[model samples]
Target: MSDYFHNKRIVVTGGAGFLGAYILKGLQDRGCGHILVPRIEDYDLVRPADIERMYDDMQPDVVIHLAAVVGGIGANREHPGEFFYKNLMMGVQLIEQARLRGIEKFVAIGTICAYPKFTPVPFKEQDLWIGYPEETNAPYGLAKKMLLVQSQAYRQEYGFNSIFLLPVNLYGPGDNFSPASSHVIPALIKKCVDARDSGADHIECWGTGKASREFIYAADAAEGILLATERYNGPEPVNIGAGFEIAIKDLAEKIV
Candidate 1:
């Protein structure tokens, strides 16, 4: 294991969350021993004052910002305003605070949901702004997309060592199994498991069975983030993906 992160004091904003667990393990595997995770309750990152205090308390050399208000389409629709406001505030405040503190590096994790609805089959970083995201998810998508803008601006103006990454839909164990907020994978798993136990014959799902999506295992996504944190320092965004897409219908069939 390379000792690139051996002694660097790294602060992962969402270091205790679903994806955060895998990322922490990945960092540990690479011999990164100095990781600080300040929970959201202790420091509500949406509030500027808390953001400032967290930065002051942590005094980190590197920050991998993964803290976000995210969930499946149902959650997004029910909490569009909350999602946009909280996500925008957290990312904006976190990046700005990291900048003011003169940190060594800032890594921002974006989502595939931010892409335009009709993006070409294999989405590319350059095609991010060609159009708006799907209506159901536009609010959440645009809110997170702002991070890419913020990261690029910071790098250009202050020459900050910040990089933004876009990861496709991620799923694996330790996922949020809650029906109200779980993403497609975990939500479907829960539904199928419950039905199987009750001896149900069929399941119900949303959408027209036309939308397609790509996925990256949670562990793989974590490794990709660590790799970007250590090896990549450019302003241009990079994608962490499995390089394969599946139609929603096909995915559901396989899951069931």
Candidate 2:
């Protein structure tokens, strides 16, 4: 760890986002001197011209792409087209432009949702393409999965340096708790907290509580991303997690 990121001018596409916030802190902690976070309002990454403009303005030596149109199952079902199109366009265009600009490295953040619907317990990185993803969020997952394809392709063809990382369900402070699109952990916590504040005897939850998931603290996930950015340059994607899984029923009991 010779301060690989200390002097590099890094650009994080979604630097204002939940995970992006922690990534910014990680970079700062690493003594990075120049880190640019492109806000979507300022630079709409889905558009190719804006991506080029971002490159011209930031002049980054490295790029860590964390921007994505994400949501829980409900949101995914409601806006599959938007999720697929936006996430796909943003990543594809950004990576292409970054390559053309000759950025030293690119770090693409992917999702565990990209795993197959029936991936065996303790999913392995090699099982990514064993089958199609879970139907609920397949569009978003597949969209992000293309980044891996692009990363490997560009690496082999043009010698572009890029890496992909897959992080599992993320939960911690600042987690989204919106009823319309929050993930399991935050949604569960919110329900419990709201019930307690209102003095309700019980709260209702969806599903049979049979599902299982693995979550990484947002800060831990950020550190993993930064480490991969500094150290990993391989063709395969890496999984970032706590290396454990828990059942939803068990998790709910613990929260209660």
**Cα lDDT of model 1 overall?**
0.90
Give each model a TM-score.
Answer: 0.98, 0.98
* lDDT of candidate 1 at residue 20, scale 0 to 100: 97
User: In candidate 1, which residue ranges exceed 4 Å CA deviation?
Assistant: none
In candidate 2, how many Å is residue 61 off?
A: 0.7
Model 2 Cα lDDT, one tens digit per residue, 177-250: 99889999998999999999999988888889888999999999999999999889999999999988999999
lDDT string for model 1 (1-256, tens) is 6788999999998888999999899888888888899897799999999999998998899999999898888888899999999989999888998899899999999889899999997889899989999887888888889999999999989988879899999999899999999988888888899899999998888989887889989999999999899899998989999988999889989999
Would you give me the overall lDDT of model 2?
A: 0.93
